[model samples]
Target chain A: MTLPILQLRAVGKSYGTVRVLKGVDLDVKRGEIVSLIGPSGSGKTTLLRCINFLEAYDEGEVWIKGQLLGYHSKGRTPQDRDSEAVIAEVRRPVSMVFQQFNLWPHMTVLGNVAAPLVLAKKINKTEAHRLAGLALERVGLAAKVDAYPAQLSGGQQQRVGIARALAIEPEVMLLDEPTSALDPELVEEVLSVIRELAHEGMTMVMVTHEMSFAAKISDHVVFMEAGRIVEAGPPARLFGKSATPRIQQFLKPWLDRSLSI
Target chain B: MNVSPEHIELLWRYINAMLVTLGVSLLAAFIGMAIGFLLNVLRICYPRQLSIPYRLLVWLIRGTPYFSQLMIVYFGLPVIGLTLSATQATVASLALYSSVYFAEIFRSGWNSIAPGHLEAAQAFGINRWQSLRHIEMPQALIFALPLLGNQTVLVIKESAVASVITLPELTMTTGEIVSATYDYVGPYALLILCYWLLAQTIALAVRGCATLLTSPQRTL
Candidate 1:
């Protein structure tokens, strides 16, 4: 069995007694595309942030490629480790693409992509520009390298965001509803990029509402509701006969519309 | 009906003197901006230690009157064994005054930086320093430029105070020529016109820079 690139064992989080995620266990193996399907406020985004340690987990262990991220005990005071050390490791190994496409407005598309390599990795400018060009080309945004983020459309900006992530050469890519902010016409452009990455066997965890795309692209589908995973299986099993009543109820209206159309 | 040629010569001499004072004001403004830039970098990079001292300095400068401060340096410093020439004292006082305004200019610019950009920089693994250099400082300066330009104009107008120390600056020369020639209207009116013209030019330059520096709107 391939060792999982990322594993969260009993990860839990809360904001002043309002529990956001509880006993959330997930394992994402190398080269696997995992789709996390959940309704709004179901802890999907929180879980993704937890993997990168952006949101502190109140309880449990987050292990990345067999390195224990941290061990938090039940009802124990949190120890303050230097976030910079963990941040360097986390930033090196993983990159997250946000829903809103948080591209730096002041930077050009090439500058945005080249920033992480130069700023974080200390890559030289010439090499950084080269890698940035490669990343932009991979996202079909080679022509927009010199364009500022403000000059790009929503889909183009999101693709630039993806390019920025790819420029870092991370092992795992965490996408928190990457295309949800795009218009329907623009969604396909972003999804196609994601689909190509999936085909290349890049490890990815996606929180998405795109049922058909999830069914088509995900190796495993984990259905979550109210801060817990309600079902987990291969996409075929989950979307076909074995889809639980909750998922069925959730997808019924949309599924019926598609069938009628 | 005839005015002394000496008085006419004084007017010419005063115009040259006024030019020097204008140059000094420009130099002070530039130095104050540089110091403010350093202070802003320190505030962002090392906020805990530097902010207190920065606040204290700005407070002391702004709390006192600029003219009195000039007097303190030119007249009072001699008793403290740190005697400076009248021109030097005027420049130092103007720089001190401008720096207070400059620091405030920087603080406003610093606050204007969007937190999202900073977080994005942090997430990219750029340490604090790199983020400020690559992201924050450039962006903040865009917001800072107009206020600094306004302060520059204010510094030029306030250079009139330097004439009190008998520095032979524009305003003082105008006063001397007016007293001797008994024609307050021409010299003083001309001085006002010159100051207004300079202030307007600074304002125009600020407007031009503001247009150049406004970032394009982001779709994301």
Candidate 2:
């Protein structure tokens, strides 16, 4: 019961010769918000993906609620990768929201949220729809359940994305630049939905460029650069005078925009 | 076009031949899609074991001419003690010939699905079977429909190749009528007309299915 909801130790991944995540470590306790902030191509999104085993962590261990993910043991050989059933079981408590709002284009908003419940959880359709309704209500999308993803505006589609993640009742949700794909005017609606979840004590790890929102909502802020965590701590430390000069330089633009710091 | 007794007889003969051709084409199309779907699934889920060999099989089938393939089915297999009736050989050969291209269509269909979609499915811990059925297959079918319509027309036309084995389908019947009356133009015209009508019917039907399957969720 004391274990952190999600744990990663020295996790590393390489796409052939290109190393995408290099020896990153972090812990997210229950009811915590950790925001990964970095420049483009700095592996923030890859690190979040590794937590769900969406991108395999080839070099280290990820423990979800005390169970190791991806591999059956410490061995990193291809043979050591766990079976699909095993990987699915280990990652069952995790869910993800995508930058592209990867809602199935062929499904209505209700169908999108209820899909994992039906397909992954094997719950009956009626019950799945009922739970999906609650999740949609949470994101204020209850009225749009019958609508298709493309029928909705960008912010509305991403809310459906959040509702899909929430419908699974995930122990932790990974958001890969949740608002990045939205038009500038539409970002706030999706962020408000996320802010509601944070207030309700949702455990989440988000990769975001929303400097002020991340500063406002995050309990722990991590600065990453070139595939490694460069600096991380409480928001005040990371956003204020104690930040590394490199991290400061990275935040300088947002700082000029006058972050809450 | 004056209505004559000989013309009525020719029209009747053409109708019977059209039925036979439809039977063969329909049977071949279904079998080809089933085999192609299975072969595609094998390569995707078991790439290390089956990918190279299946790719070679698909390539070999695609490269060979249909006429020679039909000859092999009709003549070559009998030499190895696998004899089949002429009609059986026609359907079997056409099915085998088209399955590889169907496999290619399926591969392209799956490839057209965004990587992000699969990643989201995986992140939810959707089982492999469920993911295939619910996530990948439906979307893939959307991409495959137009290609499938194309393959359907190709199979109908290619059934003409079965005339060499004397299966008595439309093309074979045309040859017989041509020889009997020395009337090349009328029987040939009937042959083209029958195939053109059949192919268009199927294409229209496939388009109907596409609309039915996609309309409710069709992004506005």
Candidate 3:
């Protein structure tokens, strides 16, 4: 069997005394779309953050392409942790799109997209701009290259956020509630961009509230509740014939809303 | 308000002193901004170690009067064997005075940036220095522009305090002319006019900079 591109082994994270992620174990292959769905405070976002080492997991380990992230050991102490430069290098293959569409408001769209290339990848300015132009074109924001984030609508700004992530050419894209901050109309445009990326065989781990979209695109759906994974399997099995009562109860509101629509 | 040839000659003689006043203010502003930038960076990078000392220094500089600070630099320092020339003492005191205010302006500007901007920079795997240069510093400087302009104006006005140290700047030169010609109203009024014109020029230049820095096209 081929080794998974990303793996999480009993990952746990805590804030002081309160635990946010409780023993999360997961795996992702080369080209898979894994949708993490749960109610708020269920640690879905924390789990996604751990995968990219954005939030260091206190117990267990996260491995991307077989290299440990955040720590050299599972020991819960500052001495066991890797240096920041080492952490950055180990997680170089991953890029994240934040829920708030965290584009630098002071920069133009092209500058925002080109920033990661120039700053992280150490690419030359002229080539970075060329690649950034391509990424913007991919998101259909080619004309808004010189436009600032404040001038764009919510949907357009989120697209620029996605362009920024794509400019780095990451092997896995982690999106934390990409559409949660968008308006009803604007959500569709951002969703379509992700859907297109999914079709092109991009590996993604997403925390999303759109159950219908998740059921449609997800190869596997992992249901989380109160910082633990309650059920994990294909969307057809989980959404169509859920084994756990917790998952069934969780999906009922979403199912009812979809049927009515 | 009589038109006298003597007053005109005195004014002409003192033009170089006006230039010296302008030069001292400019030098102080430059040095103060540089020191303030360094202090802000140290505070941000090592808050635990530098915060108390940084805050205390700012308080000490700001609490005391500017003239007293100038006197200390010029007179008191000689007791400690650190004697400085008049111009040196004046510029040193002025720079120290201006840095504290500049540091506070920069701190407020840094606080105004959204936390997400820095997070985004980190998520992109940019190092600390790159993040500061490409994201944090540009935005912070833009936010600080108006207050920075105000500080520049204050610095120019405060250069007058250097007159006590016999720096031969505008105010001191005007006093010399007044004593020589024994014409109080004419020389004093001319001194006020020169200072006013100088202040107006600084204000105009600062406004131009603020507009350029805050403009969307120029910022990008």
Candidate 4:
């Protein structure tokens, strides 16, 4: 019985006056596939961003592998930000895949994947390139290593995005609506790559709308509304006759769409 | 001989003047870009520290005419206990005058990038400096090359303003030669041709560099 790899305690974030996440608590153990599903503006994406300290939650604490993130300690103000070196060390194990693919347009596929390793991990160029090549090959993009992001299709670019994240060898991957920017046909290709990572016991916290995929792959499905987690449990509990009205109501549209398909 | 002695001296003067103009333009362009890029970064990243001062400077510079600015640096600055030579004033004033436009170009370039691009970099523990260097700046530069290139070429033409200070650049040399030799058809026509060719060369060089930047593999 080891501790969870990620722990969120009363995590809250606000943009000036409007609060986006409130008292959100989540625990993700090693190799856990946690899927956050909700309607738009539910703070699920915000929650995912908070986990990586990308948005910098204003209140409470985010614990990655038992080390506090964002502030110096729990229940601290945003002003009590940690030093960059400390923040860097704390979040070193985290990597992200963005909704927009977010591949650096100036870099080729291989260069895009190799940059973070050299930049973040301080790996030598030769070693970083080798690791990046392997990551690309894992995502099945070896043929397009020299191609620029603009030259690749959306699916291939997202795969490169995945490869870049994977190259850093993070303990947990934060995916913010990974397929939301893709065409319907392209979504499956990205999903398949994500699905492969999930099956390989790669720990991931995904913000997704693929209800059937979630139902099939997720160990735990969290239903969020407004700025809080309304309900969360294993897939059977959340998806199968949800006890919470909000969870059922949220899943109803997605369920119907999936069922009809 | 292919050319007469008097004609050779005139040609030599023209070449020297063209060199001065080219030197001033290139130096000013690069210095202005470096200042603009640093100012843009400071304002964006530390708005509280830099915003008001930078805004005041930019407003003052952008609001004034380049000729007056050149005069102020060359003439009026001596009143402020900071005298500068004609060439120094030309380079300094042109650099300052164009810095505002270059800053605006850099600002647009930075904004043109999606937030996700920075976020992706940030999440992987790529610090602010690393993210800007590896991910943000290059893309912003590619976005800004055409506009930045335009401004650089414009500086060549704008250096004509320096002639008023008797800096002996192309335009000043043309005036001097035309007055001495009474040959408007030769030096005047040559002045126009000199500027035309200089601007064209810079514009072509910038386009070639942009193509290389945007598509490096093909160039390789």
lDDT of 3 by residue, A205-233 (tens): 99999999999999999999999999999
Q: Best candidate per TM-score, number?
A: 2
lDDT of each: 0.83, 0.90, 0.90, 0.89
User: How close to the true structure is residue B165 of candidate 1, measured as C-alpha lDDT?
Assistant: 86
The model with the greater TM-score, 1 or 2, is 2
Better TM-score candidate (2, 3): 2
- Please compute and give the TM-score of the first chain of candidate 4 against the native first chain: 0.97
**How many clashes (backbone N, Cα, C below 3 Å) per candidate?**
0, 0, 0, 0
**TM-score of the B chain in model 4?**
0.90
Q: Put down candidate 2 lDDT per residue, A111-203, tens digits, no spaces.
A: 999998988888998899999999999999899988888899999999999999999998898999999998899999999999999999999
List the pairs of residues colliding in candidate 3: none
Give the per-residue Cα lDDT of candidate 4 at A99: 87
Off by over 4 Å in 1: A70-79, A237-249, A256-261, B1-15, B50-53, B182-185, B200-220
Against the correct fold, how does model 3 do in TM-score?
Answer: 0.91
What global local distance difference test value does model 2 have?
Answer: 0.90
Candidate 2, superposed: residue stretches over 4 Å from native: A1-3, A16-19, A258-261, B179-184, B215-220
Report the Cα RMSD per candidate.
Answer: 4.1, 2.8, 2.8, 2.9
The DockQ of predicted model 2 stands at 0.43
lDDT of 4 at B59: 93
Span of 10 residues, lowest total lDDT, candidate 3 chain B: B211-220
